[model samples]
Target: MKKNGFKVFIVALMLLSLCFGTLGAQAAYEKTQPQTITVLGTTDIHGNVWGFSYENDKETTNTGMARIATYVEQVRAEQPNVILVDNGDTIQGNIMTDDLYNKREGAHPVMTAMNMLGYDSMTLGNHEFNFGENLITRLQALANFPILSANMSRHDGTMAALPYTIVERAGVKVGIIGLTNPNAPRWDGEKVDSFIYSPVGPACKKVVDIIKNKVDLIVVVAHVGMYPEYDEEFGSDGANKILELCPEIDALLVGHAHSTVSEIIGNTLVGGARNLGREVVRFDITLNTDRQVTSHAVSVIDMAGFEPSQALRSEPFIAKTHQETRDFISGGVTSADGTTSGGIFGKASVDFQPKNEIMGMPEGKLRDTAVMDLINAVQLANSGADVSAAALFSDSSDIPAGDINYGTIFGIYKYDNTLYRVPVTGAELKAYMEWSASCYNQAMPGDLTVSFNPEKPGYLYDMFSGVDYEIDLSKPVGQRIVNLMYKGKPLSDSQKLTLAVNNYRYSSALKAQKLVAATKEWESPNSIRDMLVQYIQENGTIYPKVDNNWKIIGVDFTSPYREQVVKLVNEGKLEVPYAKSLNVNQLKKDGILK
Candidate 1:
């Protein structure tokens, strides 16, 4: 009986030993099985491949993909398992890329550079649709990596590109899904054609479910950026929504707002690099044997002073193409004898040129500037519409005094918008003007400076040529435009008129409250930039004039105050806390209300 009891005790002890031995082995194996994968991300590159600004016609300190290449190579040397991804907007921003497409007709320079850099995947940005599907197809063929967008579907419900990609690195299976902004249909106008853009949230959820079990780590390379407020209904904030819905996603790299961000929400790490290759986001991820992400680190490397990578500069085809593009852009339109070629601008004189004209008057109000005048004149001349609606695309979009080149043309007109002549009733025109005028913040007494509505973009604040109107700052938006006049007569709501507007603004105006429902009288196949180029070459000189047709009536501002406000605002030093408030007195105290 004692011997049987001893045997039972010994067997029980042996079982206990085996249980602990298994646990110890598992822990030891987990410790030995850690695999690290490095991810490099860039977004909104915008065709700044040479690290130079086409608008300024000079090298920029904080931009370009060439500089990013050097930083990428350094990381590659340190880490053997590195994955590179782009968040789209890789084309259609700089004239260099545009020239390459229009002139060379070969592989796009951006594609060549990205391929040489060994990009694993890229999402489609809204701007990618600007040139239409042909160029997009050509690029896809040239690219060695997958250009993806899960939310982008064809009319027949086919995926436009690969929805997601699973890449293996150092034994880590990483799943990446790409999402684009859903507003592409509206913003890109007819450029998107039959492609349907789904809301980012739903697309991401669908992709995540399919890949969650197949891959150990999930990363979303979204072309959509963080918004001031996340609207679940619109799914505007794609990155955050994915993080919230798909807990399996370990990282979210974003772009499109041109803003930088880094934060951890729940169990995911989110980061966005600024536009123009000014910065890049890198993720150092550690995974265990189970392929579960054990830990990760995020870093944003600024490319301001980094040396250009030899990989980019040493590539003979890329370097030669870049030089050719530089030379082409440097060519400009000038008179044979260096004298102004007479045209409508000849009457306004050289002052009408876009050189130094200020678009906004002092006291933070809209004023007629030659920049808009020239653009409006160009549109009207080309379309022959009764009225022309135009806006300042960029605050620094200035044409230097002497010569106008392709570079200058792009600086003034940023997008590849085409001119359209549309018919509109007087009421609709007034409504359009009102909607534009509402871009200004309500003025308060003692406020010496005028400012735009903080919630609105500068491009949305449009001015009209061939019509006269007054915007009363005291009145609320939608009721601000009063005393509308066209051709020396009181413009009646029922009056039908032909208006010239860009394709982009036409779409935007259609959505404006009570805006004109104009029908298209004519749509030019030639882009507005092409028209401007032709106009400049044919005229050989441009002089623009502002007739002071549109003014801010409620503000008591003059030339001196206008000068001060313009300087401050253009310098990005304009501080108007009451910009969105109706506090005129506070604006006065702040020396902005004049």
Candidate 2:
């Protein structure tokens, strides 16, 4: 009996020992649960290749797609578990799209290059809507990776999804869902007409619910940059709207506003703007079975750091692509000059040529006088009728003449604006003049704020010379403009006049369209930019001269001139030389010589 009991004990002990050893090995595996995810992502590339930027100067040899390809290669080599993504707006804003548009060809060369470099996913941006439905569909077909938008769909409210992809790395499944920004109509205009955009919050929740249960991790590529890179100083992206509403997401890959944020929001990790599309973001994540990420690491790399990968930088293909791009920009045909031409801006000359006048249009002090008069000449010549207040000024683009490329033309006139001749009753005309004066209202922070917002910089810094006005920062928003008048006449309420203007501001394409609503509208036969090109085409070389028409009215409203005399005599105020001068024009002409 004792021997039998001992044998039974030994068998039980052996079984227990084997079970304990198996448990120890299982615990070790659980502790080191192998998983690492890196998303090499970018946004708002806007076809900027070789780090292209014309904002500061004529041209810059910035980072390009080929370099980015090489960098993507290097990153993948270091870690095979990385996914490459683009946030959106990759279709336009460069010469690549211009070629495609002009030639009626395929999608961007940059897109092709990105595909060769291995982009795993992408989203739609507002600019993508500018290409219209057909082109977007074409682009969708060409994309090697899934282009996604949770909030965007066909004309109705149904879910539009590409076959959702699950990428497994180290035995971990990551589900990536795409969410596109919904402000397409406000900015894109007629191009993407009936495509409905649902509110982002509900759509996000739906996607999260759909993916969270099925995968261990969730990554959202958000094109909704709440506070766009364009709005840096605010530190508050308009995008906070979506983030505030959607908390179910585990990780967000943000774009649109184009700022970077490696942030924790409601158990989610969000980051963005991987170096202007010249780089990608790599993120490492660790997760629990509840499918929640417990730890993570993020890094970004610039493509310019690497050599051009052979797949993207082929010389024969580049030369062929270059000529094709050029041809498309030249309106499917090249001008006699080796450059492409757009619009019809020509030195058509002052229509009447000031039959009895002399002194070369009277050496105008303001720039728009001769240009406005010249436009009036063409209008009257075409209509055989007297017209009032024709506006002609250089289109607002910072591109230099030497650097005039396809991007310049597109930026200057993204709106397909035509010229309009509107006839308004004198009262309506006076009201419009007042409102136009109001449109002149803008305040630079440097002029008033203790410090300027460096992050924001000012918008393009426009210098409008055609219609004169004033702004007083102290005054309320609507009351800043003073004593509005036109053509040196106190504008009568009942009198009528004809006004010429660009269709963009005329129709209030993006903003309030009602400002110029009172006047009857007409489309100019050619765009103002086109008119300029036509003018240049007629002449070999070009020099724009001053065309004086408008001037600052109600100078007395500018300040209390007489009160300063008291301050000056009594030493109440510091001696500001020009401040004391009542006649600004005379003061300027007097020069700086003491």
Candidate 3:
């Protein structure tokens, strides 16, 4: 009886001690103010079922989905207030996501994995349209988190189930709204449609009016272009324009461009996780109930940095489900090892960066092959094609300024961009060329701008594949091209020839050639990258500015009215000479060369 009484006393003491410890920790936490709101985010995921492939970089690692779930679990344990968000491109980044949902109609592995992880919110990217509206609606139904978009609406003007959500934490409500890339259906092709993306300004204003005073903070989850090139409607880059236009927004979770921008703009904090499930963005946002900016802290929790999350591992049949879906698409166009001299090379010197980072004008070698060889091969390969051209810039902002890797390849050649053939008159071709050059023009308050940023939403700044041309930004969109030269001679309108471009250019929203509003067109079996990569692989090494595929022959303006084209020279803009050729190393150092 005495021993039993002693044991009970000991248990009581331990329980009391535990309670005291909890109270002490709570008291300490209450005394100090929260530092910042860390917004954990990922973008352009395009369904990275494989998770991050490597340790240091965002390559594929075996940790796979299991690791991601485990990581999220640990993070949640550390800070229960952490809001997990996805910035779009989730539907299409990986073949597993695309191949499964696109090819079959049964289970969605990405959605399943996300639900298991308890993602807070997500936005839509252009690639999401690839599955068409039916699949998206179904996916939305499957997604537990609020799908947000202050901008996107159905064709009939009804909002999707996914609307912006104001997640409340510590008396502060953070309003998160999603906006699809306006050019998604227009630039992507027939695979996507049935939804219209509204401009960021109006869309943001519309949402702001409703949530402004009601919420303490506003966050825009955008998959639109990040940098400022042309203005479709969102103004500059989505974040820049969002901040410029919507001061109410406290932070922006950015994606689409895929460039690394880690800093605060105005009062808002901006952050993004690298492509694939490689990195995780950790954000802890603190706010007052009054809805004005108070304080927030943010970090990109490199997914590779954490051990693969346990949630991903013990997710009760998730691995088996994923394996089933993965094995289903094994026979499709998606396959491992695109092939190379050493490892898997998506393409040769012609690394196709979906964004401007890799195969960019700054990364001169790939840029040279991107335009020159792409155009040259298309022109030469097609006897009837008049001129072949390729566009470099994109509306999406965060193309990584680093070595070309799987993600680089993924970003550069994002779409199932097939070669499109069209017969356009020389006059029509020149008009097209002008459209490309006009991408460089900066619109003043008076001069009208395209409803969208050309390079970003889609490739509006086209460099002729087979012809050399100059831009007279002085002219309108139809008249921008001048001194149209083919092989050093002035171009003739009557020349009967076929022009080639990605299938995306054929869409009615964007004009490329025969594919535009034309019922009849030839779709190449080879991907656009396949041709370019094959050319480089066969040609060995590549040099920039070869054969002078094109030269800036016109408009030299400055600042506001003139083009924002920053010469790479020792100028204050970019450190390098603007036109000098570069390699992967130099390109990485320059970061995202303007």
Q: Pick the candidate with the highest lDDT.
A: 1
lDDT of 3 by residue, 1-594 (tens): 999999999999999999999888875564354534456677766566545321123535533545566677776677756677888878774544543354456557778888887788988777777656777777778888877766777778898546688886544467888876666655666665556666776677778888887776677787765554335453633557767777767677777775565677777677765666666655566544333346666666555555655556445555654554334322223332332312233233433323333223343322343434544554357434556655554333222332323333334444556677776667666656655554454323232122223243344445566776655544555665667777678889765556776666667323523323333267777666455455544554544235555554333332242232233322445433222322333444556423
lDDT tens per residue, model 2, 1-594: 999999999999999999999888866565466556677777887765544443332333335566667777777798767877777877776554543442254545665666677777777776676656776777777778787887777766554545246666655677777767665765554555667776655666677777777877777777776464423443223455556666766567777765556666767677776435655556677666544576887656555556655556564554355455555454564432234554222323332112212111111211234334444444444333324443222223322334333344444444333556666555554444444433232333212111112332222111233234443433433454454455565556565656655443443321343444454455566545455445445563434444443443323433333344324434634233211222333433455212
Off by over 4 Å in 1: 1-32, 102-105, 228-232, 332-365, 511-514, 556-594
TM-scores of all predicted structures: 0.84, 0.66, 0.63
Best by TM-score: 1
lDDT of each: 0.76, 0.53, 0.57
- Local accuracy of candidate 1 as per-residue lDDT tens digits, 447-480: 4555678667777877888888888887888899
Ranking by TM-score: 1, 2, 3
Model 3: how far is 493 from its true place, Å? 2.3
Worst 10 residues of 3 by lDDT: 443-452
Off by over 4 Å in 3: 1-38, 52-71, 170-172, 189-193, 225-229, 232-237, 287-294, 310-414, 430-490, 508-594
Per-prediction CA RMSD (Å): 10.5, 12.1, 10.3
User: Candidate 1, overall lDDT?
Assistant: 0.76
How good is model 3 by TM-score? 0.63
TM-score of 2: 0.66
Error of 3 at 41 (Å): 1.8
